[model samples]
Target chain A: MKISIKRQYFIEQLNHCLKAISPRTTLPILNGIKIDVSDDQMILTGSDSEISIEITIPAEIDNEEILEIEEPGSVVLTGRFFVDIIKKLSGDFVDLETTENFQTKITAGKSEFNLSGNDSNQYPLLPEVNDADSLVLSSAVLKTIINQTNFAVSLSETRPVLTGVNWNFNKDNISFTATDSHRLALRRLLDKTFNTEISNAIIPGKSLSELSKILTDSDEDVEINLSQNQVLFTYGNMRFISRLLEGNYPDTSRLFPENYETKVSVNNSEFYHAIDRVSLLAREGGNNVIRMTVENNNVELTSNSPEVGTVNEAVNASAIEGEDIKISFNSKYMMEALRAIQDEEVTIEFFGTMRPFTITPSESSEVVQLILPIRTY
Target chain B: MKISIKRQYFIEQLNHCLKAISPRTTLPILNGIKIDVSDDQMILTGSDSEISIEITIPAEIDNEEILEIEEPGSVVLTGRFFVDIIKKLSGDFVDLETTENFQTKITAGKSEFNLSGNDSNQYPLLPEVNDADSLVLSSAVLKTIINQTNFAVSLSETRPVLTGVNWNFNKDNISFTATDSHRLALRRLLDKTFNTEISNAIIPGKSLSELSKILTDSDEDVEINLSQNQVLFTYGNMRFISRLLEGNYPDTSRLFPENYETKVSVNNSEFYHAIDRVSLLAREGGNNVIRMTVENNNVELTSNSPEVGTVNEAVNASAIEGEDIKISFNSKYMMEALRAIQDEEVTIEFFGTMRPFTITPSESSEVVQLILPIRTY
Candidate 1:
């Protein structure tokens, strides 16, 4: 394979391709990136079994020559070293050529690098997804959805299903939910453009997190194709494929209480900072638990460790209704929930001190976060 | 102890004090910051065995009240946690009060933190250095001298004396030298104002590095006091004390070659970037060795790995003097030396192909760096 490509463009695509390559891959071939050159464009692919990323650089972009192809062929080069070399190469254009024996020579300006390449034919084939079950959404929307809920997914592998973010599409509404038993984050969006009803897919939280980083926040549409065992995301001359987790996700809709024994509305930033400070002392006592008591228009948060001392903070609540309640919960969970609320004010609904409480943005009902209170005697 | 201080000023002083507190100290009291409240000012001190920092906040600075002292006493509080609490506290003024029993109460706005503190009497006393043997220099000059030579200090502790930078003061001239045997860096400055003839002291490179961070690059005078076992640096209401190494530092002055068979002048930045790129391939071959051959006005640098192929690049030298020669060395050392040269053009002098070579700034004689050539066939 022979091609001349702009250094900046190559570096940008290589960065995206690197996200799919894991250093701990047992298969040595998976540690390398496959390069395929055609008459008009060059495609780079990197994978580590769970996810694969393919980026295409056309011969010309926006009437400017970004890549010039001389021969059509394929080869696989070590991903980490190649990316590092490309990033540090001090030249405007890089020339890459591969011989029949898979020896690749990369040259740019006065510097040239020759690296041994593996046969591309030995690389795993990308799983195919049916186009009929595809949906298109704005990249910005997808990124927001992932960022809003992915953090709440279970970090432990004890329950495999909880390690992923469950996505359900019905009619024109798409809902994303993630939970780690202690807390849950849910985000929903309605798009009339997606006419096809697709089945629910459990995408590993880690995969969505990586995909979000590669997807720029733009108005461009990203086409997502779903199948029984695989899902594909195509956007901006790139394809990201991830394996779907095969398990039934638990129903979390009933987790939110219909009625609240007490409700308090407070400034999100003030509440977050207050909990953050109290958590410093709470963290020393183990479990990072902080207690909050609401009465009238004032809410007091306090935590103490016999060894490290205590912290007490009071934040003014806009309004409080029903019976005043005192609840003890994980400060980290509350802080994360408060940070995810984009609105200036958040309304927290509590059902006594033992049940899970729901926190929602005051301005929009599209996002909801629930935290189970820690029983502290 | 009781005082009310501006949050920003308190934070700045705490930061300097935090540097002296190491997390892995054997003595528990050393992990805390000592706070001594006087009638007119508040002094904060933190220390590990190697270094101690004391910062004083006057009752008034520039006619503005920076600290208000209601009582005079002393206490020691955990450094890391106290700093964290102060950083997150959201108030213009922080009020700290310590009882006779050493229970401290820190309050700001509506938040309050009560922390258990240790008696100041339990903290180790800082070593006192005599001002009679002191010399003063601008903070900027001291900072520059440290930065120019500290990187060459031996990182390994096998030779403890080489781990510190030797400061030699003679005839109103101060010279700092550091070497790890493989390479040496020397920075010299002539201070006519210092008339005293003081003995040389070997200051730990790590301590100097920390002191440099706390010293702002300004024209303010930093008074350095020398003692038998410790050195004190006083600048901007702060006093930093560092223990001195007892052993004699090896003499590295004679290591500089008196005459050279080959010399080359090249653009500092260009040479650095070229070596940086070539180092990528050299690194894969194990010792990160790269070779340079100069003849006439052309200089070629090349490095090869039997398994990764080879990279060769030619850089235009401004001048090449004496006999043509080939030399091989660690690319990292060469790159670091080139980076340390502040001048636009750098001149490298070689003494034979296997001996040590020197890289110096083309326009300044105050700094010199010597790198030993690697014997590669």
Candidate 2:
């Protein structure tokens, strides 16, 4: 392949595909990025066996010439080396040509690099998923769903299914749930209709995390195609394909408590800061447990490291009604849950001292968060 | 101690002292910052045995009230905990008071923390350095000297003296030199008169690294007092004390070549970028050696990793007048020396292949940098 392209634009596309080329890939070929150049555009692909990302750079964009192809060809170059050279080049445009034996020569300004590339035919092909069972949603909504639930997924691989976020779709809505058994986070979108053949699937939390990073906060529609073993996400000129986790996800639908004896409405920042201070002392010890007491419309947090010190902070709450109660839970888990809510105020409901409590945004109950209380008594 | 101080101002001083509190400190008391309250000012000190930092907050400064001292007392609080609390407090002012059993009450806004405090008397005392042999320097000059020489200090403690920068005082200049045996970076201030008792001393690289961070970019004069075992730096109500490295620093005054067969003048940035690109290939393996060929007034750089590829670039030079030379050297060392010089153009003097070379600013020879060449067939 012989082509000269805008260095800056090419670097951006390279980064998106390079995300899938993990350093820990077992397959040596996966560490290289496959670049296929046709008459119309150039496609860059990277994969780690679990997730594959492909980005396209067309010949001309917005009437501005982006790429000029002298000869159409293909080559797989080492991901990090090519990326570094492209970014550090001072020239406005970079020229790439594949010589005999798949040797690629890259030239920009006075710097030229001749890299030994593998034959593109040796690279593994991304799983093909037809647009059959496809569901479309706005990028913002999809990113929100990923952010709110992905953090709560299990980090352990002992239960492979728990390492993913469980997705269930109905005729009118879709809900995402993730839990590490110690805590659960749930987010649901009721407006969009998810009409497709697939009703449920467990997507790895890591895959969704990477997807969220690349998703722009625009109203652009992202089409998701699901197959038996793979799920494909396509938006703009980029395609992301991830392998679905096998095995049955835990039934956490009944994990949230139904009744509560106490309810408190607290400002996110105020409560967050209070808990952050109290956790300072709690973190001094092995167990990050902090006690919280809600009474007289005020929430008080207390934690102490016997050898270090103690911390007591009073958090202002808008409303605290019903029976006053004191409970203890892991401060870190609760802090992560509160940050994910992204709301000014949240309503926290407690069933009892030993039972799990739920926190939801005060304006909407679409996002539900639950944290099991620690037996501190 | 009982005092109420502006939280923002206090946090700034706390950060300066916290630099001395290392997590690897063997003495537990060293991890705590000692706060001493007097009628006129409050002093905060942190030490990890190797270095100590002290900052003072007066009751009034520049017609602004910074601290209100109610009583005179002393106590030591854990460094990280206290610093974290001060930074996160939303209140304009923080009130600190030591109560029974040395438990300190820290109140800021609605957040209060009761922390266990160690007796201030238990903390190690900072070494006293009188102003007998003193040197005064502008903060900018001091910071520049530290930055230019510190990066070249030996990180390995095998030759403990090499881990520090050797400062030799001349009648009208002070020369700072550091070498890890592979490469040497030397910077000399020829204008400053040395009117002190001490002729030379070695300061630890770590101490200078921390001191460089806290120095501001102003022309404010800084007082440096040198003692037998300690060096104290006083500037803007802050005192930084570092232990001196004992033992004879190696004599390398003759390392610079007196005669060179080749002399080349090159732009700093041009040569820097070329070496950086070439290193990308050499770094693929363990050795970071890159070849340079200077002939016909152009410096060509080439490097290759057998498994990766080869990179070649021509660096623009203003002049290359001397015998043609082919030399190999570590690109990382060259890049670092170039960055530390802070010069637009430098004149390079090469003795020959496998011989050490010297680089100095084309404008002047105040800052001399040396790099040893590697022998390659």
Clashing pairs in 2: none
lDDT (10s digit) by residue, model 1, range B1-377 = 88888999899889889999999999999999999987998889999989999998889989999998898999999999999999999989999998757899999988999999999999888887888866888898888888888899999999999999999876767788999999999988855445555558899999999999987789999999888889999998899999999898887777888878998999999899999989998997776899999876679999989887788888868888988889999999998888777889999999999899999988788889999999987
Candidate 1 wrongly placed segments (more than 4 Å): A190-198, B190-197
- Tell me each candidate's RMSD, in Å, in order: 1.9, 1.2
Any idea what lDDT model 1 has? 0.89
Candidate 2: residue B55 Cα off by (Å) = 1.1
Superposed model 2: Cα runs more than 4 Å off: none
Fnat scores for every prediction: 0.83, 0.80
DockQ of each: 0.77, 0.80
TM-scores for all predictions: 0.97, 0.98
| lDDT (Cα, tens digit) per residue for candidate 2, span A335-372 | 99998899999999999898889999999978999999
* Residues forming the 10-long window of minimal summed lDDT in candidate 1 chain A: A190-199
